[model samples]
Target: MIDRRHFLQSAAALGAAAFVPLALAQPYPSRPVRIIVPASPGTAVDITTRFVAEALSRSLKTPVVVDNRAGAGGLIGTDAVAKVAGDGYTLLFAGVPHLTTRWFTDNPVTFDPVKDFVPIARVSSSALGIVVKAESPHKTLGDLIAAMKRKPGEITFSSGGAGSTSHLCSVMLNDLTRTRARHIPYKGNGPAVTDVIAGQVDFTCQGAPSVVPMIKAGKLRGLAVTSAGRWGEIPDVPTTAQAGVADYLVASWIGALAPVSTPAPVVERLSEELVRIAQSPEFKAFCASQSMYVDIADRRQFLGQLPKEDAHWKRIAQLSKES
Candidate 1:
């Protein structure tokens, strides 16, 4: 006694209903998110990322964790993130090294830093401080330069690694002043700074967050900061320009990135959350405490600057080779 037409319509309606749940499935980040730090735990990038992750966890209302994959000067962790699915679940807490690593290395790099990743946000930037042991005879940046000139390769400087920003800073210093200094590479900036403290190395150029507290505690003497203006935390420290190195300006920036295949909506959401966090007063204060300043740049802005950064570092690498 079934009506044929009505029965057919009912079946069709049921078939369509079955797909509704699938279409209405959860949005991006329904599960925990992991941010990979491509350096040791105590590095400046790691410290800044922990702060961002905590704020992001609250903003997204999801658990955000930091995974350190330190080795090969940040290549391991960065390449790992580049290969993952772009589902918004995995991200990279990236820095200057992210752009400069490939240029500095002789081995084949698996991922293209610019093409393989999408920018999320840029959180903070800090000047590098040229520091030495408090007891060292070189009291100022000029003194250090003079010593390097006097002894050429005899005076030694330590860095996080050969291709690291710290190393590039020292290289730039030597090139600018027409001087020479022995280069010592360490696994991480913490150890490099420690060696300078232990008197094993003559000096080191490190980010403010890593060395500012030590400078305050009198463990390290900050000869000059590699910025146009002096760092607020170490107000007395002169800028490189003021210290007679007129063109030796450098700044280290930290930001977030995801695999390029990530959906536009997901990338937008992450960028919005990060921008919000960076603009918050609490975050600003936190960055200031570490001698960094909150530099909020969302996805578009961050992407726009990548090419310029790449060019700058490429030039730096050439300078290193020439020297």
Candidate 2:
């Protein structure tokens, strides 16, 4: 009895209406997610990322894997994440180097560190330790500073490499104290700390995880930690300020980030899971064992700190150029 054209239109409308709910009900992360650690395996960043990935996999009910992309000071892995789709399937396990690598490298960076990424959550942060061989004559941080002043360019310091957190922390120390110590860049923190222990270099600033065990084992002496408060694991070591250096605080942090094009809902979901993982007792204990502390920040809070972090790194870069 009805017109044929009108009947066909009604049927099409009914079919379209039925499909919308099914599409909307589809869950995010239907497949495995991979977190790319822009550093070699066994590094602190890689270890932390792996821990987070495991927890995330359990929380999201999907596989979460860590892929190490170590090269060119983390530029390779970072750039790879920047170029990937924003479907939350791929993410970056990033740190301060994410912001400072471009400043230190002469090579052209393909992605904008600030503009190309979105902060999901901040996992943890730790202060670096200024260490020397246990048998070194520089007994304290002040003593080391005095020695640098006394010899100027003669006191050599080693670092993981140019633009590393260790390098930047030492650079900041030199700039703040107005001392000139020759920098010996190594291929990695292991070699740099090794040379310190070998007495080939005067001293080096390194993250706690890399140097704490050495300090405890009498292989290295902790002069000062670059934090406002003393690290719990090594309470005997004073902070930089307490050690008589002011305005010389530097802490390295690791966090999760995705491409800027990622949808807001996906970002929110990931952020929630990360924040939860970061706050759990198990995660806190794990961080403490590594001489790091849980520093959980949500999406908005994490994004808010990037500007200041970027500016701080920029200033460090300028100081490096001047020196």
Worst 10 residues of 1 by lDDT: 21-30
Model 1, residue 24: what's the lDDT? 51
lDDT of 2 by residue, 98-180 (tens): 99888878788999988899999999998899999999999999999999899988999998878889888988988988898
Residues 242-263 of candidate 1 have per-residue lDDT tens digits of 9998889888889999999999
Q: Ten-residue segment with the worst summed lDDT in candidate 2?
A: 314-323
Which regions in candidate 2 have their CA more than 4 angstroms from the true location?
1-25
Clashing pairs in 1: none
RMSD of 2: 3.0
Alpha carbon lDDT of each predicted model: 0.91, 0.91
